[model samples]
Target: MGLGRGLAIGTLAVGLLVTSETPALAGNGPAYKDSWRPVKVRVADLLGRMSLDDKLGQMMQAERLGVKSPADVTTGRLGSLLSGGSSQPTPNTPVTWADMYDGFQKAALATPLGIPLVYGVDAVHGHNGVYGATVFPHNIGLGASRDPRLVQKIGRATAEEVSGTGIDWDFAPCLCVARNDRWGRTYESFGEVPQLATEMSTVITGLQGTRLDQPGSVMATAKHYVGDGGTTGGVNEGNTEISEQELRAVHLPPFKAAVDRGVGSVMISYSSWNGVKMHAGSYLINDVLKKELGFKGIVVSDYNGVDKIDGKTGFTPEEVEASINAGIDMVMVPYNWQTFIDTLRTLVQQGRVPLSRIDDANRRILTKKFELGLFEHPLTDRRFLKTIGSKDHRDLALQAVRESQVLLKNDHHVLPLLKHGKIFVAGKNADDMGNQSGGWTVGWQGTSGPVIPGTTILQGIRSSSSKVTYAKDGTGIDQSYDVAVAVVGETPYAETKGDRPQGMGLDDTDLATLQKLKDSGVPTVVVLVSGRPLDIAAQVGDWAGLVESWLPGSEGAGVADVLFGDYNPTGKLPVTWMRSAGQQPINVGDGRPALFPFGYGLHYSRHW
Candidate 1:
């Protein structure tokens, strides 16, 4: 009989398998079912019993929306499922997510082997897919704080939130050392230097906790492995055409750090090195990452990452064979998962892809499942559900927001606005939570206007001072107001859509608003809410003060904290600030003058 038919017969014979609450067997069951056995031993025992179909199913990961029904997971024997950035259940509440996870997990346990499914999500910056979850500053903002310990705490908090929703994997702490600000995903990167990204990898520890099986601990993924940030022209998924020496020096340190930290997974990048797609580059994926770096954990492909191996829209049999052979343990097929599974199985049977590779992938994947204690605790631990968006997490986010504020230009102590003054707040980002949070907040590219619950900068300013006026476009402003604060910058954007190919300056609306504030003759403070540095040299001379509040998610009060002296501005530039868009890809020690040098920041006591 075929593997598929055999799987159906085996599942029927097994009947309704025991739930995670009960051990599948008594003292006499297989060693793999025993929690007391070492993870390696259990993985080996389980691998011996799994059919070829089971192993194939374990290699496929489909998107949650693409699953035709719960039976698809059981029949296909899927090992994992993920919610795309915009994918969410109705109402998008914490409880709803928990319910959804439990529903999917129940189907996985019904398989013949009863292996629990490991659900994954892009909890990039705090369980960002769920509504009401605490949205912390993006990686760029944390990079400015230069506090690894703080980043670790944020990671722990993020893990708790993710665990509450029953997600075992987080595709985060994007270890990319963004070489250019024009990259749309620059905000996702820690900084431009390998050292900074290396230091921030502490988040892997926080996410995985002391152990993978520990309560509230989730598996962490060091993502977009290799030279994603060094792509020429700052193009998303573009080619990185540097030498092997330069690649090792600039792009390889963070992955090494992640491997050293025992990160549960390393995601392959969509970008290529020397015109070779990372998804299919065996030299880098197997030789460099798996062998040289000694990364024992699973190597997962990015979203439909394997499909792009052939540089086409859809995946080919060759693409599948190349990616799997390149040391990718699991493929995130998303939509066309069935096709992937069928093609992979055919390739293996045809001797085009060896069974040794399949077993190797299964072993790596099962090791994590065993380590995570999935066999014993397959359901959502409701204990963490209460922790989502809890006051404690929000407080932590507030502190992160405070530390991420980089004071660029504070002329004559214009900041720490006196306790008694009428403050006029204007600009598109001033009163918008979505803008403050930036991309990856409840949605993919993230939308504007209260997409999630969070205090806006204007609200923060109002609460800080009794006298405060707000206008979106800087209307009705005069010298009568002691200060005019314009919180303006790029709105929400993610990945390719966010790439600024040409001009990277303030928009006409922002300019008009700043002009209004400038006309008032009142000292104006320009608080830029952006994912990366903007081209503001021409206008920097016009503003009395400038602050780079790089997407301070959910905690605008922290921005107010710095503006009112409750907290001092200490954040430094994580990436070089270019004087003009013409100076793209500028970096420290690159022999190019910057509008603001890397590591530049001013305190309230210091004046320029």
Candidate 2:
């Protein structure tokens, strides 16, 4: 209702854009007659019709239920609402999600222009929203593919399912080129290569596909803007002490690729760069990225990134104004938008921010709304909403799961899991859906328990093999043992907490567990589910087989497909399994000596 008509861009290339005094807009009356126009024209018309409070509503985003009461949905100035991985609806069902989306849209639509409110979810892998949507490999697995087109295909598939659920935006394609393998988010990048990161930017293009105006496609956000992946000491929200030139050349390349692809939005990072918080870096945000890179898109703040920019951090609420003046168009307060609105309004009234600055941010966001044709088709097919995780999508996810499995070791003949022999499945992860999914599943750091409902490795093996038994300990190995699949890897974690494998391989507990199983006289097939390669060379030598499952999501059953002779494991390590954490940032392409070089996957045509 608010955007009036939609904004437009004729071709996929960023070059087809027409620069406006502000950003793109839809202008008044109808939607796109043609696909190349700024959204400002439409937004200006909508703004003219809206009350002061309504115009202010366009500035903030919150959780769907974060507002104190349902009435808060109509609070006029709230621009967007989101449900992070953990934030579930009251009923927490497909029906509930749709109802929430429609209800919020109705509130925003009730206003004069009927602008629909933007509803967001962390649909990192498939519509992880609808319980059973086929969750594919996390970004790390895709990184190993080294195939940008495949990443784009995955993005396109992700967008289709997400959009089917009545959501229009996705926070995806984290462009950070992981500098330190120890970072918890190491799996979230397209590996440590800047060029590969640049190529993966095409995922944004593929998500939206040929027409940005299409209903099936969703807007892709190039995220954690500059140098977030390079945090020193591998801590989340830590400082990146690289030079400006290094920042531009190394970290900024993928973002530039995103902008070039006509990416509608960019999420500012939470980390600092060169001892400066990225949230407050006016020169980089406004000058280098916006002006120099010629990026004509909406700049959004990361979850609470705006707060990190303070007077102590060299920027006041007023200077924060300078950030928006520089480039930021929206703030994702996530939990409390009212606080943000109060602060932003106070800054503007106190003359800390100029009218032009406010207009700049508003225009940039409104342009995207217009270009997306949101005003024209506010409601998606409710029928498809019921079709959340269809069989076809699950097939796609299964394929990705197989494609992502890397066979890291095979001493003589350690695998294919022997269809006839008894297989001992041992490890905490072997039976848990949550452990295999890793971080960013149903929760932010994901969680430990039966996360929605996905097949565990044990179940997959049982279904495939004639005989399979499981245990946290490999008990009774003497009677049934031919091979024991000691599944191990990182637990569900995000950012800092997950990154520290306590100087051990991810799921270092696996070492003791596997050793216990190995000591039981069972030839072990160690399967690691980690975001990055962990130094498990000793563990590798101890085992007859080793495999890196790289945070495989809902379709973990694919591991069984390859393990049980249905398919062959073809994935290679996207990163080197370092000798130790001290070998931080060591990669195959780095020309540095490593315990296990990158591209080190070895596939056996036939098993022993």
* Candidate with maximal TM-score: 1
Model 2 Cα shift for residue 174 (angstroms): 1.2
lDDT (10s digit) by residue, model 1, range 464-489: 89999888899999878988999999
Q: 1-608, model 2: which lDDT tens digit per residue?
A: 32322333222212335445533433453333223343444555454455545655676778775787546767645777777777776665676766767777777777655666676777776666566566778888877666776777777778877776678788887888887887888888877768778877878977777777776777888888889888887778888988878888789889888988888788888888877777778888888888988888778887767767652432346646755665677777766677667666777778777656776676676677766777766666565654466676667777778878888777767677778888888887888887888777766888867886777777888888877878776656664578889888778888877666357554556767877787787788888877787767556678788878887777778889978767777776666667777778676567777766777777777645
Off by over 4 Å in 2: 1-40, 47-53, 311-319, 506-509
In model 1, the clashing pairs are none
lDDT of each: 0.90, 0.73
RMSD in angstroms, all models?
A: 5.0, 4.9
lDDT of 1 at 317: 91
Evaluated at residue 295, the lDDT of candidate 1 is 89
Cα misplacement distance, residue 291 of candidate 2 (Å): 1.7
